[model samples]
Target: MTDSESVRQDTHPSGTWDDIKELPPSAKLVAKVLEHNEAMTQQTIAEETLLPDRTVRYALNRLDEKNTISSSFSVMDARRQLYTLDINP
Candidate 1:
């Protein structure tokens, strides 16, 4: 398997990506960005994925519904929230 595949498997032995497979393409993209970056705000995710803010927000909501990602208010900026993968990819 490729390195990315290995990482995906490592993220969740049962297969987090497998769970994500049914989600929207935008959600998958957002998950990938979070996997690589570890943690970031919605704006950063949008910048990294080159997706619009609304699209990113929608993706985040989808991920949230699946319990795939976690978020906490940024210590430096309470108005912003830092998002991270709950699955540890």
Candidate 2:
């Protein structure tokens, strides 16, 4: 959600949290994971969104291909991923 939209949701309880249901299936799931937690790996996306890991991986790959988001990995756990919205893109 945008800053203004979040502010509006804060003031109102008109299905604000249901924004996830309004998104395109894949983006919707990704949005939910990002909203609740800090950074998310494909694993986190799978667990949080109830999407299969392969599905999450594909969606994330598509997001990257479109330059819609960015990701990195933790040094301690190379498999642990971190994602960030690519506002500049």
- RMSD to the true structure for each prediction, in A, is 8.2, 10.7
lDDT of 2: 0.56
TM-scores vs. true structure, each candidate: 0.79, 0.60
Clash counts for the predictions, in order:
0, 0
- Could you give me the TM-score of model 1 versus the true structure? 0.79
For 50-69, candidate 1 gives per-residue lDDT tens digits of: 99999999999998877787
lDDT of 2 by residue, 16-73 (tens): 3333343457875675566566566677678888888888877766555555555665
Candidate 2 wrongly placed segments (more than 4 Å): 1-24
* Whole-model lDDT per candidate: 0.75, 0.56
